[model samples]
Target: MSALILFDFDGTLADTAPDLAAAANRQRTRKGLEPMAYEALRPVASQGARGLLRVALGLRPGDPDYEPTRLQFLEDYAAGSTVHSKLFPGIEALLSDIRRRGLSWGIVTNKVTYLTLPIVEYLDLTRESAVLVCGDTTAHSKPHPLPLQHAAREAGFSVERCVYVGDDLRDIQAAHAAGMPAVAAAYGYVGEDDNITTWEAETCAHSSTELWSAIEPLLPSDLR
Candidate 1:
């Protein structure tokens, strides 16, 4: 077992916003509603269908149409998984550096496996990641710590030696709840209302270079 660096997929590791925004717009078109601007949907991309539904369709969980619309949104998203999904700048180099440092890294995401696995494969990370844990991998997901804990266990890392990096507030909550440190990816899809500075993260990486600097020290020096 070694020190582990785990990431949330959507905004943190990969920029899936383009495809998500497209899916949201597709839903709007189906509903005969005007498409929402991409800028408006980008911030909520990390929140998945619920967020998109709220923004593009204005459908809340309380509405009868919420569940069906959410399902349709997911369906549309799955159909366009890799169309515009790509890792953020410097991510490939970061992964290479992590490998060179002899540390282990993986993805722990709220995205379901059916949707996430294909994207991971398309990104050619299926062979690179030490482990890949999705929303359904455990009984519960983020904020409950099950997903992060599952990733650590599967990756053969100790809770104390694990660091979770993510773009959303729930990521910080989950890592801390699991007794692990969390790094906030400030360069990611941080919403207009979110305050990364106050997320109680170990550190907030405002850019990929900053992320590398912040993460390098958290990794065991021996591994580096």
Candidate 2:
């Protein structure tokens, strides 16, 4: 059977932090909080809304403004989702390869549905993705297997015949919990000190080119 490749959106395939960081700063400015630098927010791109809220608004879990602040951030982000977002270098080539090889591909991200749709569309990925499982699509998000498992099922692939690639530890955790082989995207938003080697990844691809090289062999020889 052919292997199905499931990719994480924010850090793995796209650089969406610029728009997200801009939204975070906008929220901060409205709240009279100091704006944070874009670089500072990059690492948390895959961490989702709450993490950005914490960095930009400084809202604790119990803070009364937290929910409202998060809502505002989401609204602003939706408007500016693709302002600066783009696929990583070599990603187009890799995606082209996947399609040319007739391999199934899909996205499973912790990004909420509304925001995720715009970004995916902006990247022109709508026609290419075979399945999509957003953060709110399932009851639970990453670090939980339900989303990935559900995505695999919907894609008509067994979990064992699939491979999930993502940048964060939680991505690895979720893939493992879902009974799929996981790969760490080393070229993603990972910090220098973050130890991806410790995770139970099938392998780590340091760049989109490297990811292509690694996965090409796993595909059928005719496809390769």
Candidate 3:
């Protein structure tokens, strides 16, 4: 049977850190603080506004300044979300290969629809993806199985016939909870301290170039 491949949007399918970091840095600049290095900010990109705000301003959710600052940061991000965001090297080819193999693919992300759709369009994946499930698309996000389960159902695949790929530990957790196999994207913005080995993915792809090899083995013989 043909299989379904579901991917996380940020860090997995696209290198979105440059633009995410830029928004965080803009917050710093407005406060007369020098912007943090891109290298430092990139690691927390997957964590979204909460992570970026903490890094850029040392502010956490409950802090008095956190909510307003987060709003501003998100506003800044929405304005230029696609400016520096692009698919990781080899990703377009990888998606094409999946299609040629008669497999279907979709995106399941914690990114909200408003924020996710624009980038998906910018990367020209809007028409090609079999389904698009966002944080708001379900009641819960990653680390919860709802989003992944929703994606599989929307794409007409059983949970066992799908594979989830992402760079975050939560992605693995979600896939496991959904009764699907998972692949860790080691090339993505895995935080500096994260050890991908312990994420318990069925296999780990060190880069987009290695992804096909890692994923193909996890598929049924016919699908492979």
Top of the candidates by lDDT: 3
Off by over 4 Å in 2: 217-224
Local error of candidate 2 at residue 176 (angstroms): 1.1
Superposed by TM-score, candidate 2 places the C-alpha of residue 65 at a distance from the truth, in angstroms, of 2.1
Q: Give the TM-score of candidate 3.
A: 0.98
Model 1 lDDT tens row, 13-80: 99999999999999999989888899999999999998888988888998999998888989999999
- In Å, residue 156's CA in model 1 sits off its true spot by 1.1
Q: Write the per-residue lDDT of candidate 2 for residues 7-82, one digit (tens) a residue.
A: 9999889988898889889988997778898878877767767878876667866799888888888889888998
Clashes of 1: 0
Q: What ranking emerges by lDDT with the best candidate at the front?
A: 3, 1, 2
Top TM-score hit: 3
Worst 10 residues of 3 by lDDT: 215-224
Q: RMSD of candidate 2 to the true fold?
A: 2.0
What is the TM-score of candidate 2? 0.92
Better of 1 and 3 by lDDT: 3
The clash numbers for all candidates, in the given order, read 0, 0, 0
